[model samples]
Target chain A: MKKRATAQEVAQLAGVSKWTVIRAFTPGASITEVSRAKVMAAAEQMNYRPNLLARSLATRSTRQVAVFVDDFANPYKLQLIEATTAALQAEGLVALLVNINEHLDHVHAILNADQRQVDAVVLLGTSFREETLADSRLRDGGPPLFVLARDSQLAGIPAVSCDSAVAMEDICRHLAARGFGRPGFMSGPRTLSTALGRHRHFRDHWASRGIEVAELQASPYSHAAGAAAMRAYLAANPPGARIDVLVCENDILAHGALDVLRHEAGLSVPSDMAVVGFDDAAPSALPGYDLTTYRQPVGRMVETLVDMLSGRRPHDTIVLRGELVLRSSA
Target chain B: MKKRATAQEVAQLAGVSKWTVIRAFTPGASITEVSRAKVMAAAEQMNYRPNLLARSLATRSTRQVAVFVDDFANPYKLQLIEATTAALQAEGLVALLVNINEHLDHVHAILNADQRQVDAVVLLGTSFREETLADSRLRDGGPPLFVLARDSQLAGIPAVSCDSAVAMEDICRHLAARGFGRPGFMSGPRTLSTALGRHRHFRDHWASRGIEVAELQASPYSHAAGAAAMRAYLAANPPGARIDVLVCENDILAHGALDVLRHEAGLSVPSDMAVVGFDDAAPSALPGYDLTTYRQPVGRMVETLVDMLSGRRPHDTIVLRGELVLRSSA
Candidate 1:
């Protein structure tokens, strides 16, 4: 490997102090433009770029954020990852992606992020448990924690997500208008507080309108799991006694449920069974699916997350409203 | 912010040297078991984990790999990202995700990764251009670069990807057996050498069997782009003049083509027009699509990449054969 040009070498070439060379590269550091130009020219000529990892020791800021994501099977997570990474990059912050699904538990992911000394940690999916986070050392002296696209019940850990209560109200109102009396809600195996909170909002919103919602659980957040859950639901309940509409917690589950209803159960949508999903996934707009779902403002949520991390916004739980997209399915 | 416990404090509490504390935390560092146990106890009590960034300065290895990904709309990229991050994490290396789509060009992403002093850089998608990479400073003393799921033409940069030649031959034989003479190939706008390489392999494989393949180009790798390309093709050529089979470069393109055929064009599969795609994405297995596609050995490819990055394997171009998954689409 070729030896990299050090700051001392660049300073010697530029006829400036090593500290001047450092200040020339440091963002927002006080340095004359002439000195900065000379240092940059010398550094460029010598193929020398300031090592961020080395400078991070003195500044105590790596300008890298640990982005924890799970539920890779969910297509919506892709949009979340893209938006979060892009937003972080726009703010000159790099995203250190931590695969929460690969580890034995979420605590391992958190501890690993802590060891890296990232500026902050952002949880992007819905799989993290509040209890696990509370019990972890992250709460003691680790980097600041922020949640995106899911509510965080842990104290001092700010979160930005869609307004699920209002979204549920919108969904229930639409279903009531369509005269769908009985509705079934499909959710994943995660027992996080936000998951339960979404279920409660969904069920309570329907109950207020004199309708009871049934609950269905999928083991994991995948299309196949959704189909299996729907298949099992059909086997347990006769067609005449089945729910009129199915409301899935996310779009992937909804796609699975819709497939089972159309192919396995031989049922027509909106006539025999209507289906709805959340997160208005990319496929939901396609003609094949034409799914009626709620669109979470992922771009806005990511912006809020970046702002919170950069101290541009207050570190508190912020909920943004999303639009309910209507289609033939519901 | 609370002050983090330093190595000095941990060493004082453990009655050991500061170097001993670092050795205990390092993976392959030499330390006595008694000293390691004492350091561990002290670390747990004081919550003093050795900072990886600080350690990277002395060791010159950050144990961080820069993973660059583009074309996020293709669902196959999700599987690649998950597998790569999981494999890297399992090997005690963190993945710093660089969003190539967000940057002005691939060169910016490379330079950003270079600034971080990552141990290696892995390109996970096919959108990177060799000319752009060659023009960048990456060719001049940057970290070792590796390409995953795509062939790299640059000298000394190793790549691991599916064998496109064999895959095309398998596809062509299947098409001939089905008596489909006229076929169309749909590709994205990336003009990289590998993109043209796949096209050449497909066209040449079909030509050797006395069949000429038609070409179609999609500006971007998205469902909407695919649909637009298919719609344009159908508009330009009427029913009798259209190709018998449409082979998409990726699953997302095939999905768009399939949706247009079924809904807008009012054509049936394998009768009026048959469609095939590469990369058996998650939705390809759904009953709604049931797409005939190629399945890349993502797990095995990621394992090879990690091994190559860790110096366990030689830095050479590896072409692994993928399977031709048959379904009703073709």
Candidate 2:
């Protein structure tokens, strides 16, 4: 391999001091345009690239942030990852992504993040429990921790999440206005605060109207679980017996419920069983499903997350609301 | 905020030297059990945590690898990201993820990766072209670059990619064995080598069998593009006119084509028009669409990529084949 040209070689070629060569490459450093042009021309000609590793020794700022996400298969998590990484880049911070599952391996992953000396760490998952937040190892040694899209309210730790309570109320009201009486919920796992809160709101809102609600919680936020739950519910209720609508906590669950309705039960959607879901994932908008759902403001939520990480905004539990999108499913 | 405790304070509390304190915390560093126990007790009592950034100045290895990926919405890309991150973590390296789109932003992202002084860079995308591979900026000053899942053959650069040509040949033979004739291809954009090679193989194999093929190229690797292409094809060919099966270049496109067939075209999947796809993403196994597709060996590919990055394997173009999975769709 050919040896890379050094700053000293560039300085000699440009007929300038080493200090001028360094200043030309440094952002916001004061240097004359004539000297900068000469240095750039010489560096370009000789393929001179500054060694950032050596420079970081003097600056002591790596400008890197670590982001932890648990569910890689979920489309919502994927979208959040995209937005978070882009926002980090906009702020000139590199995003070090860590795939932390609910298993014990996540503990090692978190410790690795601590060892990397990231500027901050963003916890972006729904499955992280209070114990994860309360881990002394994560709290003491790691960089400042912030939660996004999950309700993690540990001491001195802040979170940014979607306002699922208000959205659920809005959805319930919308369903009632459409003359839907019998309602059922295809719920996600109760371990997640977001799913638990949404389920509670759904039950309370419908109970006030004197309507009994039926619900089943999927083992995890997955399509197969949704289908299995729906199938089990149908086995008990029998076909042609009515549940006017099924409100799914996530789009993936709703897709599974729809699949069960069409294929297993031989029931037509909306005409026989209307369906609604949250988090307007890409597939829900397709012609086959056309699911009516709530669209989370991921772009705005990511901006707030970056601001909190950079200390530009206060560390508080900030919540954002999303509007309901009506499609053919309802 | 409380000021963090230092190694000097721990050493004083433990009645040991500063060097002993440092070695006790360092991974794999040799120190006596008694000294390590005393240092740990002191650190626990005082809430002391070593700063990695300060130590990196002496060690010179940040143990970070930057990964560049485009098209975040694609499920295949998400799967690749998950596998890549886990592999890097297994090797004691942090994955610095950069979400770059097909725009000028990727150029800046690459430069930032160079400036961060990561140990290496891994390009994990199918959309990257020769122009991106040949950019002098990436070649001159950056850490060693390795392309994964793309066909890059630049001088001094190595790539590990899926053998799409052989996989396509296997798929065609499988289809012919299943009594499928008059096959149509839902092609992706022609700029990508993976897509171009797959399309070329399909054409050659079908032409040798004396069968005519219909092809439509999508604007992007998305479900919407697949739906549009299928809609155009159906409009051109009347209902009940023979196009026996549709072979999609990817799962997202296949999902779109299935949507078009079931909803817009008012046709059943296999009985009316069979369909197959590449990249057996999570959604393909859903009950709604049991899509027959090829599953890429992501785990093996990621292992090879890490081996190449760490100089454990030769820097040559390595290709792996995917297996075809049969389901109800075909």
Highest DockQ against the true fold, candidate: 1
Please state the CAPRI-style docking class of candidate 2.
Answer: medium
lDDT of 2 by residue, A138-250 (tens): 67746788888767657777878778788888898899889999999877877783423677788889898888888877868888888899889888886557588999988
Question: Individual DockQ of the candidates?
Answer: 0.78, 0.52
Please report, as a residue range, the 10-residue window in candidate 1 chain A with the lowest summed lDDT: A189-198
Model 2 Cα lDDT, one tens digit per residue, B11-41: 9999999889999998899998999999999
Model 2: lDDT of residue B324: 94
Q: What shift in Å separates residue B25 of candidate 1 from its native position after superposition?
A: 3.1
Clashing pairs in 2: none
> lDDT of candidate 1 vs native?
0.87
